[model samples]
Target: MSAPITVHRPSPTGGRRVTVNGAIVGLAHDDRDLAEFLRRAGLFDAETILDDPRWVEWRGGRAHHYEAA
Candidate 1:
């Protein structure tokens, strides 16, 4: 099965669209923002799982990337 969290590609202005369980969470400009989004989603250990493939899927570019190329 796919991960529950999905960090989409960066937009033209910056920041990536974050989703939890296929629902829109918010826009994250950096890793800190991503953590906060996850925290709000009830994942208290958001920071530690950012790099864990079982928790998140970084699309388009890569993890922590918030700039469109």
Candidate 2:
């Protein structure tokens, strides 16, 4: 059986990646579905994201801002 997923924001600038069951899954720079997948899988960390400016995708691309809050 597949292990549970634990998502965390990417550490590098412009280098997006996701974690699932201790495994890494690369994410597209502007893939909205990828964002949803992370959220649904209980891997998203909002507080950690807003606390770090560099990891923010605000300026990456208009198509990448998947959050409205």
Candidate 3:
């Protein structure tokens, strides 16, 4: 199986960093940006990505501002 995707919010200005298998994919400014990045990378569909456990782990089980489109 592919390595799990990782989302990180390092700094308020740094935006969200998306990584897969230790490779940096993109730095997103918001939910839409993140979705776009994932779409472009063809890693996961928006719905699946939003529902992924990795997102919950990264966000401490809290809901983020981004929603699936």
- TM-score for every candidate vs. truth? 0.95, 0.30, 0.62
Error of 1 at 38 (Å): 0.3
lDDT of each: 0.94, 0.45, 0.59
What is candidate 2's lDDT per residue for 1-58, written digit by digit as tens?
A: 4324332443365534555455555553445545555556564763444324444333
List candidate 3 segments past 4 Å from native.
Answer: 1-3, 12-14, 54-69
Ranking by lDDT: 1, 3, 2
lDDT (tens digit, per residue) of candidate 1 on 1-69: 999999998998999999999999999999999999999999999999999999999998877889865
Best candidate, TM-score: 1
- lDDT for model 3 comes to 0.59
Using lDDT as the measure, name the better of candidate 2 and candidate 3.
Answer: 3
Off by over 4 Å in 1: none
How well is each residue in 1-69 modelled by candidate 3, as lDDT tens digits?
Answer: 443666665445556677766767787667677677777767557656665675423542233543222
lDDT of 1 at 52: 91
lDDT of 1: 0.94
